[model samples]
Target: METILEFISKHIEMFYLIILMIFVGIELIGHVPSVLHTPLMSGANAIHGVVIIGSIIVMGQAHEIISLILGFIAVIMGTLNVVGGFVVTDRMLEMFKKKK
Candidate 1:
């Protein structure tokens, strides 16, 4: 408990920044028109693809157990995000196809 408090105190600014980003992201996303969602998600997918590669590199270089674990989790989450984004984008694109 003491260690957690110390850690939080040490990184208080980072925590605040993260909280601020979350709120800003929520507001920005909420205001995006539905027509823009596909393009936005494609951009996000590209970003997450980079994240997945970076996480894999981190996992390969990680010597500590905690670092390895966190890197693995990051890779998994990034992969999921990328795959889900592609799936959604594909479905969205399908809607534009004319009937057979």
Candidate 2:
């Protein structure tokens, strides 16, 4: 674990690059058409579900109160986002259905 932390500290530039890439990726996603947003959001929500799983794993391994609290918050927020995404996607699809 110490080795990992040392490596991260040594390669902090890589982390910065990754953060920049993430922001750029988010900006590019914003350029997607309105018609595509719902599907993309649903996909993102599925990814967030994976994030929740990771957070749960982290929570299980957490030894400190602060880490536990942060992990729990991550799980809760991810759940809310996923549920909200599904609701929005469903509503968007409903508009495309032929009305009786």
Candidate 3:
């Protein structure tokens, strides 16, 4: 466990870059089947809700004010994306509703 922690501590930035790349790859090439895409995307949107809580967690561990500020910004962006995603999804569903 200590060895793993040491390795991670030594390679924090590389791990971050690799994770970022993986997510980018997922965005670019991880096509979902039509039937599952909307549901998965909505589920993914729910993930953004974690950002604000993450910011608070980060704030507790922050070594500098800048880190706190950046965390706050991330929280704001994540919240906006979560809310906007839901709103757009609702509009899309409404488009398909049969009108009287």
Candidate 2 colliding pairs: none
Give per-residue lDDT, candidate 2, residue 91: 72
Q: Let me know the TM-score candidate 2 reaches against the reference structure.
A: 0.53
Off by over 4 Å in 1: 1-48
By TM-score, how accurate is candidate 1?
0.53
* 57 Cα displacement, candidate 2 (Å): 1.0
lDDT digits (tens) for residues 23-54 of candidate 2 = 98789797788887767768567555666778
How many Å off is the CA of 7 in candidate 2? 12
The runs of at least 3 residues in candidate 3 whose Cα sits more than 4 Å from the true structure, single-residue gaps closed, are 5-43, 46-49, 60-63
Model 3 Cα shift for residue 30 (angstroms): 15
Which ranges of candidate 2 are over 4 A from the true structure? 1-39, 42-48
Each candidate's TM vs. the true structure?
Answer: 0.53, 0.53, 0.48
